[model samples]
Target: MGHGTRDKILIAAATMLGEDPTAKLSVRAVAARAGVSTGSLRHFFPTQRELIDTVVAGMYTVDLPDDPMQDTASPPAERLVACLQLLLAQVGTGESARGYWRALHAAYVASPPSDDAVHAFLAHERLAVHYVERWLVRLRDEGALAPGEPGHHARFLLTVVNGLLTERALPGDLTRLEFEARTLMTAASAVLRPASSDRP
Candidate 1:
């Protein structure tokens, strides 16, 4: 029963995260979602940070439905661009993208965040980095990518996506899509230098 209750709490937290990436997993919100008392939720996860860390950490193991990394037949750049698109898809565009950035600013930039808030933000950031690193690692192992730190390459790619995500929230014309596609392609190709070659 103890384990079951813990699982319920975790499932509820994860569900809330899935529903809204910005969902503040307050003890009351999570407990109510899980159909458990606040005390029960606290017994399983003593703090909001712990609950968030556990949920986001689990995301590292969850495979995306159509992971581009699995398409070995595709060129490295194509696979990587597809992967970045997956990230973009999650954030969406226009109002949806605005909401994501809004939540981020409200939580981290509007005022000083508590330690727990900072931890939650970092947890989600790490999960994004982890997914990108996995793809880079696979390309490296297959000799498709130049010898370099996968984490560095992952951050580089994520930096590109991050900029694009922010741009999506701002007003732009139809050509924005064209520019975005070109930018993603360039970023992907830039990082996918062949193993046999040296980057200038």
Candidate 2:
């Protein structure tokens, strides 16, 4: 296949993944979606494993804005609430969020991911942590953080979010999920001292 054909396949695969993170990116499926032949898809990706690994690596690049804290005039609590929303938004939203987590849980139950999958998963996680740390660093720079390492505090808040996602992945219960998410975010914000309380 030509490079143009290969680009079509990759674009189609990325679109499918963005819509559904656990999309089965089989060559045949992606080829059909891309309106290309399986042979053409294989010409570019070479193998299903290669295709998946490449897609995961591409998807793992989640970056934060240089200035994630958009409103310097807002109260520290309000700024933190915005940060928490940004962090949770990374998990995704609506049916996409539910489907993403559901697929991940199913994969865990059916079979473990391969070594490449493990590496890609770790890369995704590290990127997420870095994104969160950026927000925490912003808060610290604004003198809105409690006296402690931003990395440590960011990890603690992320741990709480993960715990909520794990313990409360109730099927067809988006309302409860939203409530619990807000409650957890509130708890996360509570860890931060008021702006006035920052160390001189």
Candidate 3:
């Protein structure tokens, strides 16, 4: 089928899956939702696995900043904070995005060991790490950070962020953004602090 038709089918499938994680995704259901014919859906995704795979892949695809740490005009710390905020914004509690995330997590947990899940998890983790690395690199280049391994600091930051994401996913009183922001600031300070009081 044409690109438009295929895209429509994917959208329909994603919407349905978001609504009900346990919903059986079939060609007929997706086609009906998309207002397209079964033949068209088949032309795009010949099998259920293919369609599901595509949706899974799309979930991790995010719009990353071209230069997440550099705005040249802004302070490096400000730029870094903005970049981090952008990442956090993706974890929406809204119905559509939240439902999609919930469904994705359920599928990941239920599926058997597979390369697809492994690859997706690695890719997302790398992206988070790379974002942190960029911020560290920029800060170091600008002489804002103390001497250290930027990559190591980046990995550490990513670990912290991942933990925060996990905590946010669970049912509880959501941590206020102000608290999160302050916590991040404190962590960043600790990561960049100078070694000794006597050091000039």
Candidate 4:
């Protein structure tokens, strides 16, 4: 089978899992979704376990930010908030976020995808924390952050972000969501900033 054929199956499976943690991704279902034969899918992924594992690994693969990661020369607070917003953006928000949700719902309601009942959705949380940690490294390099564990700072930032995403899962005023997000980012920056103005 063509390598592209194999990749298509994996991509189809991964997209299904991201949209619905409970998605049914049988070999036949995935093959149909990928526009390939069951034989082809089996050729790439010998068993359901292999297929599900590949999809779980891909659960965190997404375009988290439109902007380049290296562009962190802006003010520490601004950069910090931007990083958080990137994560929230992935979680969805307001009108733009709704489009993604609608599509995900539509995909779930109409699909050719599931395997094991296991959902590796938490990989998204881990990915978000890593993204935040990268921002912290940028700050530390610029002498803007106080010495401490980057993971600690990352967890704190992700906590607020995860809460924001959780709240967003339900119906709410967009303005309220934006306000709460801002408040969280501000508090996170304050806690992470150095006490003195001196660089080092």
Candidate 5:
């Protein structure tokens, strides 16, 4: 499907932000990147804050595939892993992706609590929580998660994932991708199948 002007603007903005984390994201810069005039951009986003809010909201609303846990065609464990992998892939160590994340984080930190920014940040956070909740619910239905508090477990796992992503971004003794994935899988498996004596 053909993306609209606003969509194109958002995409261009995201691409530029991803390339240069410190980008100013000015009307002129975004317009130039999108190959649209400032007037065209202003038609959709009247202000810089409006554009930033839309981009943040857009980040959360992006679609993912249907839950694999609900799909009987695939093994539950494999499906869970696939879902986790999808989340990881989004914030992986790719230069562009990392740059985008850094830029977003910097903006969040620098900006004061405006209604637009707060709304978008809350929306994005809720989306992340929702994504994890869905996965946990599906796993619970598939008998992977134990009885009691699936939402709590989901939140905990999501927090862990977020922490790992932060660590990956910072300078430190970075964990290898394989090791990080394995660690998450092992922790999840332990939480879901406490009865199993095997440990990673």
Candidate 6:
């Protein structure tokens, strides 16, 4: 019964994240969603950071839908660009992007984050980098990309993504999507260099 209740809480939290990327996974919110008492939630996850980390860690094994990396027919750069687009699509633009940043600030930036909160944030960031590295490794092994440290390459791509996320929240030109696509294409091309097909 203890294990079942814990699972119930995790499922409820995950569902909330899925429904809204900006949903604040507060203890009370999760408990209410799980149809469990706050005490029950606290029993399994003593802190909001623990609950968030557990739900995100659980998601590590779940494959993303329509992963473009699996599409071998496309050039490596195009495939990677598509994958990055999938990430960007989640945050969206304008109000949706603003909402996400606001939630993020309220959770981790409004005040000094607890150590556990910092750890959770770093873990999530590393997981994102790991996913990108995996795709880079596959491309390298298949001779679609130049051989190099995939981790470094992944971090570079993620940095570009970080910049784009900031841009998404601010007022932008009508060609935002086009600008994003071009930027990603450039980044992807740079990372896949020495490959004839990857040339800009």
Could you arrange the candidates by TM-score from highest to lowest?
1, 6, 4, 2, 5, 3
Report residue 14 deviation for candidate 6 (angstroms).
1.7
Residue pairs in candidate 4 whose N, alpha carbon or C atoms collide under 3 angstroms: 24-113, 24-114, 25-113, 25-114, 25-115
lDDT per residue as tens, model 1, 79-150: 988899999999899999999899889888999988888788788888989999999888888777755788
RMSD in angstroms, candidate 4?
5.3
lDDT-wise, the better of 1 and 2 is 1
After superposing candidate 6, which stretches have Cα over 4 Å from the reference?
19-24, 47-49, 197-200
Predictions in order: lDDT: 0.88, 0.68, 0.66, 0.68, 0.69, 0.85
TM-score for predicted model 1 compared with the true structure: 0.93
lDDT of each residue in 161-181, candidate 4, tens digit only: 756765676678758766876
Best by lDDT: 1
Can you write out model 3's per-residue Cα lDDT over 52-82, one digit (the tens) per residue? 7787567545346565565778755566666
Per-model TM values vs. the true structure: 0.93, 0.64, 0.56, 0.68, 0.60, 0.85
Ranking by lDDT: 1, 6, 5, 2, 4, 3
Q: What's the lDDT for candidate 4?
A: 0.68
Q: Deviation in angstroms for 170 in model 5? A: 3.3
Candidate 1 clashes between residue pairs 3 or more apart in a chain or in different chains: none
Best by TM-score: 1
Candidate 2, 1-200: lDDT as tens digits:
49789778878887876665556676788999899999988878887667766765664564545343767887766666666666566565556566657787765446887665565456446655666677777777776777788778777777877765654444555577678657765765666776465457
In candidate 3, where is summed lDDT lowest over 10 consecutive residues?
189-198
**Candidate 5 worst ten-residue window by lDDT:** 190-199
- In candidate 6, how many Å is residue 45 off? 3.1
